[model samples]
Target: FLICLFGLLSHYSDISDMSVYYSISVFSILGMAIIIIYVCISISISIDERYPDEFMNQDQEMYFPIHITDD
Candidate 1:
């Protein structure tokens, strides 16, 4: 994230005005944040799908610890 910010800031410093540079930084940060959030959610969903039974067992254990001993 820092690398991207610094690279963009440096690249824009020579060609654009300060307002344009600042706006770019602001929009870039927001875009990066949104992309990061989307990636995280997608990864989590993939994990859930990949381990559906494991997650279901974990959830059941979390809510009903005593039920596990019946088996």
Candidate 2:
């Protein structure tokens, strides 16, 4: 995250066109937001699993695995 942030910041001053900078900034912000959100959710789930009683209701169940037979 810091890597991407730094990379974007370093290119900030070089953008002579406002439109280009605006687009880049928008995409960068969105990408960072998604990455952060995913990481946070995954961490939360891990912690919740560690304390099962605190998050048992949040657990998810998977259906049976698909098996293929020869034709």
Candidate 3:
């Protein structure tokens, strides 16, 4: 709950340019907040968290992919 709220705040911080673009500390904290949100959600809601994202798993992989196919 708190983690999700922090993530939301940080997301807005970035969008509204509250965190200075030249600093790493603020961005790093926000980044961690976002990661914690995805990882710490209640297990009961995981059914919805991990599905229906079309081509991606929103909970696990938001940037990189772990496609398991013949490559």
Candidate 4:
């Protein structure tokens, strides 16, 4: 969020003169990319923290069990 805000502030002049549609499109894409990167990093850290046993077991089968139910 801070990165996106900083980017907009830093490049405001470059985008200000562009059409409204174009400016919004550029910022939206930039914001989405930043959010995606943040989510990926967070997930990686959380998985590492939650699964220390799995992290240590190099040869263990890497499969997740799944169950389905109708509400």
Candidate 5:
């Protein structure tokens, strides 16, 4: 929906200032990145929950396959 709106506005309209469009694009990209990160974390957590650490060595903690954040 956002893509379609951006495309239509870019193609059909004569907007002098592109700042709004650029801002919208940046926001959309950020939104997508956040959503992807959330999905990845959620999937990893679900997998860990489904298959507990008992399968691995007792000395090790639960394995998180995807680490997106720096912390």
Candidate 6:
């Protein structure tokens, strides 16, 4: 939806010079909003995973698998 709106506005701007400036402003704002939202959501998820409850079963920690050779 955002991509389609952006493209429509871009085409509209090309035909109508008057709306070109405003279209650019709107486009930039939309782009920034999307980026801000993405960053916030990712950070929140990471924070949730990092701070776990003591009672909750935790995932096993990663360890290097040892290989043994029998002579």
**RMSD to native, candidate 3:** 15.2
For each candidate, what TM-score against the reference?
Answer: 0.53, 0.50, 0.30, 0.54, 0.53, 0.50
Model 3, 1-68: lDDT tens per residue? Answer: 44555566666543544443334456677878988887877553675566445334655555545645
List all candidate RMSDs to the true structure. Answer: 5.2, 11.5, 15.2, 10.1, 10.0, 9.6
Candidate 1, superposed: residue stretches over 4 Å from native:
1-16, 55-71
- Candidate 5 ranges with C-alpha deviation above 4 Å: 1-16, 54-71
Error of 6 at 8 (Å): 12
Top candidate by lDDT: 1
Clashing pairs in 1: none
For residue 67, what is the lDDT in candidate 2? 31
- Candidate 4 lDDT over 1-71, as tens digits, reads 55665566656565554464565678779989999999999999998897655656655535533323349
- The true-versus-predicted C-alpha distance at residue 29 of model 6, in Å, is 0.4
Model 6: colliding residue pairs: none
Name the lDDT value of residue 23 in candidate 6: 67
**Residues 6-26, model 6: lDDT tens digits:** 577666534675575576678
Task: Compute the lDDT of residue 26 as modeled in candidate 4.
Answer: 85
lDDT head-to-head 2 vs 5, winner: 5
Question: Against the unseen true structure, what C-alpha lDDT does each candidate score?
Answer: 0.74, 0.65, 0.57, 0.67, 0.71, 0.64
Clashes of each: 0, 0, 0, 0, 0, 0
CA lDDT for candidate 3: 0.57
| Candidates ranked by lDDT | 1, 5, 4, 2, 6, 3
Model 4, CA-based lDDT: 0.67
The Cα RMSD of model 1 versus the native structure comes to 5.2
Candidate 1 vs. true structure, TM-score: 0.53
